[model samples]
Target chain A: MTGAACVLGVDSGGSGLRAALGSPEGAPCAGPVRSAEPVRTGPRGIDAGHFMDLLLPLARDLLAASGGGRIAAVAVGAAGMATLGEGLRAELPGALGRELGAERVALAADAVTAYAGALGERPGAVVAAGTGLIAVGTDLAAWRRADGWGHLLGDCGSGAWIGRAGLEAAMRAHDGRRGGSPALRDRAEKVFGPAAGLPGQLYPRADRPAVLASFAPEVAACAAGDAVAGGILRDAARHVAEAAAAVCPRDAASEVALTGGLIKLGEPLLGPLRDDLAELLPHARQVPAAGDPLDGALRIAGGLAADRLLLPRDARMLSVHRSEGPSTSA
Target chain B: MTGAACVLGVDSGGSGLRAALGSPEGAPCAGPVRSAEPVRTGPRGIDAGHFMDLLLPLARDLLAASGGGRIAAVAVGAAGMATLGEGLRAELPGALGRELGAERVALAADAVTAYAGALGERPGAVVAAGTGLIAVGTDLAAWRRADGWGHLLGDCGSGAWIGRAGLEAAMRAHDGRRGGSPALRDRAEKVFGPAAGLPGQLYPRADRPAVLASFAPEVAACAAGDAVAGGILRDAARHVAEAAAAVCPRDAASEVALTGGLIKLGEPLLGPLRDDLAELLPHARQVPAAGDPLDGALRIAGGLAADRLLLPRDARMLSVHRSEGPSTSA
Candidate 1:
């Protein structure tokens, strides 16, 4: 281990935060360290202080493990960066420079990272569907986004949305109402106890979106044999495709990719999603995501380190900051 | 004022708590004191100690206002009493006997109180649609309930539900997606600022349901001219009516009633609600509520004071408790 230049990449989202060390050539060196607790947000916006608290320790560990190499650049892709990112955009760069002595930084919305990870800097759209969903695309100039409105308002085809729809069907079944799904009800009971007590269990929790999303797998599991569950998946797929179509580049040769943990729902979701994407976005070629958001963050960091970043910069979607002070090599 | 035998009635719900003093004849005699904070609930169930803290002070004021009359009985109608009332039920009786000197007590679910308030002891269903929605009924035997699953899972057609739907439409419009409602978007922006910031504004709040429900009136206000808003209300009405039909007794002359603050949305909601109820439950008659939950609580307390309560008692829905020792007149 020598005083080699390495870049820091971080992915912060609903599930948690992950950090990695990468070289300017886009190769990982060591440490994809993780923290299960997500960065907190509040009245001002995404809590920059909380994010720094989480990242500083992770960066120190990664640097130590990499034999005290100097960090040339840092890129952070955070979940709420597009909307609730004022605090992060304003404070993160200065804080990183002061603390880590990293002069070059790229702050990006998680969706943009997913896009970069999926299609590099090419003109394409990427659907990042996890607990929440967002579709992002660029024509090598400007970015377009759809959905990712969180669980209550939008995120229409996201994991939370599917879970909520499934839970509603389960509740309907419990109440013996129309559109009830007995299979979903059974699954719901197995996971969340009796239907009657669900409100008491769910409403008071702060992590409700993720809690609701925890049931998405159950819905996907029941999709194979249950028409109602299958219907839910089909609708979810349609919504995902619609979001993708809303932001995908218009060119026939442009690419569309799916990324995030939700892709693990596998064929039950993918089968319908494929058909919907074909119908809604026939011109765009659907492709598998080359990597996850972490990989995307690393790639962006690498690009910044080499001063050859090709992706278009947007104030909210993706912004680069360079400190005026001389770099302090570790 | 003489030392008359007055009953203590308390209504505890999402909005707050209210306590009134009434004579055994079911006539109000003194005060209806209020506390704006709702009683807290936790893993142990509805916080009995907190309820006591709020109730004791209000009870003292009511008793003092009534010229120190003896409380013959006490009735408390609380939201979530059907499911989250274990702590309240177990501890309230003993606490009330010691604190209020009332030997007899009736603990009722808010829906049961709403039913009692609406149609007395008649075999009918009552839809309690406010921030949340629940339909409860009795056939002079057992209690039946449908849909009160709260904001996350069910609570279909509730104030929160309508508001959430309206906000979703607003987001769709903001995103330039199909099914976008520009009218709703305008209304939402007026109430909640930019559409993109709504999730950040909503998701972190413990009072999210109330906050979301605050937007419901805007949806109602727009229903007359906006088709999307009209559609949301129509769907809300259908959901409310379906919930009512699910619980209404099968008797040809059984009554159905709508109760709760949601009824204030007026013709935009009620017009569709009336038609849907008429279509869904032609056998049952729709009736205006005779009183609110507070009045129902007073009525139940009065009935208990006279030992002629007519409504069938259920362990979860409604339960009666009598202290073993002699009653203490205040």
Candidate 2:
């Protein structure tokens, strides 16, 4: 039997997969509230078969971890599902529904949960800066997207983008082609090892996204004293701030919430981002994410209508908004 | 069996493989001498074994096309050989020697031949910007390289880099993340069909380097009328100029020659690059390539001391600058 007050919410991202069991009100009610693993997936995408293999077992573990308390409802905010064809998207929620029972399911692009997690029922914008960057916003029923074009095309203020800029600076410094901190080049070279050998080590590796993002921390770590690193951070934050500022529609709220892995690095990037945003979006506020994405997933999973989630037409939304008994049925 | 006065020069670049049969004096002597085929190679790098399979036959055909020329020597100025260890470098010339009765052969980085082709023994600097950008220069025996770093690490003013920047601008315009020409977004979308489906089509292709470089032309096409595209081209040329200027040592003769596929776009890119170099490197004069890389390769193969062609310790410099018939001995 499941706790009548609790529901299950799962969030999948480039860095890890996370799951939590929480109250209908989006609060943790039991243990194993958040479980994460070093699982690999991506913006370039993975086959549905592989994605499900990772997803199904993780859900079962969380459900079992709930100690016989049934999953009152289930919602998954999965990456890459937003871009898939309708046929491919049906597989995830369908498979999960078969296992966890039907009437308790909701699925969406991680981008939607990111916006919900930041803004809740209120309207504004959320720019998630992680290994990759994408912003989602809504002004009533109209949806807007800004810069989540993946690694190749766009992702302006993302960890990978910052990392690439930092690496380029390091190379320019080493070549003495420009005036940058020698210390920045030293730190960057240490990441890849000796003397101009970065290309050899970096290109052949399959885990390119993680490796590219791995340099992002160095930009923050050196920004304080290194001119080159500081310039890079400043430029990165400017791009992010510009993107974030553009997404705000000045509707119900004018506050923008920042989320994802890169945000955790703090000031070296964000301070500049905030300063730039203040100039570009003078009336708005840059705020922290009030709750995590799982909360937002659960909020939608409950009977809250988040039309922006845009689940495929055939995707069955099993609304289970009840607060009594360990019932899997709505 | 062979024309005593002839030599062969092959220019193997990311864009295409071009081979020419010419006199030992480095002048083209036959029809369609610079024959090229759309062969697959790489940013991933093609192996020497595969390279030879493509090379040997092409050389023999070019030799035969020249009406039975006893090649005085053969040189292939290929991309990607610069970073290879001595063992790998040995394979190209060794295979070419056995195929053609040539006594002398030379192996060097494509950058060196690029410099030789542009400046010859009259040293200065040469900035070759194609799918990739590399600036090479010479001051007596001292050689300097500025930004030949491939698509991942450097290649700052390259076709691939420009295309990537242009695509990012297009995405930004499409997303309304920045104020830009919608025309740029439309043109970019035309290249890869649909606004949202680009990342899907682009990221999965095996010929990522070629495809990325393909957009460089569009940057030029739009720059005259579009602010976004104009900014990208201006930035690209500036980087190329700085790199080129930095490589030159202000010798008695200070000139920087511009070469590569991107050069054909002409004024929009080159005009800014020239103006930027005038300010950054006042003493330098910007000029066109004296000859293509194949000519430089022929010079090296003809036993001209292209000492700038730095070979590894174990690399044998078999010199056969003889005026006689087909002879294998040096």
Specify the highest-DockQ model's number: 2
Judged by DockQ cut-offs, is candidate 2 incorrect, acceptable, medium or high?
A: medium
TM-score for the A-chain in each candidate structure: 0.93, 0.82
Over A242-325, each residue of candidate 2 has an lDDT whose tens digit, in order, gives: 777777777635678788888877889888888888887776767888777777777666532222333222232122222222
Where is model 1 more than 4 Å wrong at Cα? A1-9, A14-74, A83-104, A302-308, A323-330, B1-7, B21-72, B91-103, B305-307, B324-330
Question: Which residue pairs in candidate 1 have backbone atoms (N, alpha carbon, C) closer than 3 angstroms, thus clashing?
Answer: none
Among these predictions, the greatest lDDT belongs to 1
TM-score (0 to 1) of chain B for each candidate = 0.94, 0.84
Question: Could you tell me which residue pairs clash in candidate 2?
Answer: A1-A68, A1-A69, A1-A70, A2-A69, A2-A70, B2-B70, B3-B68, B3-B69, B3-B70
**What shift in Å separates residue A326 of candidate 2 from its native position after superposition?**
14
DockQ of each: 0.62, 0.69
lDDT tens digits by residue: candidate 1, A1-330: 349888989999876889999997667788799999999989887999999999899999999888887778899999878778999989988888888778789999988888878888788889989899888888888899999888888999789999999999999999877778999999989998988778767876777888888999999999999999999889988888888888888977789998988898888899999998899888989899988888899999999999998888999999999854245543
* Model 1 lDDT per residue over B10-30, tens place: 899877999999999666787
Among these predictions, the greatest TM-score belongs to 1
Positional deviation of residue B325's Cα in model 2 after best superposition, in angstroms:
11
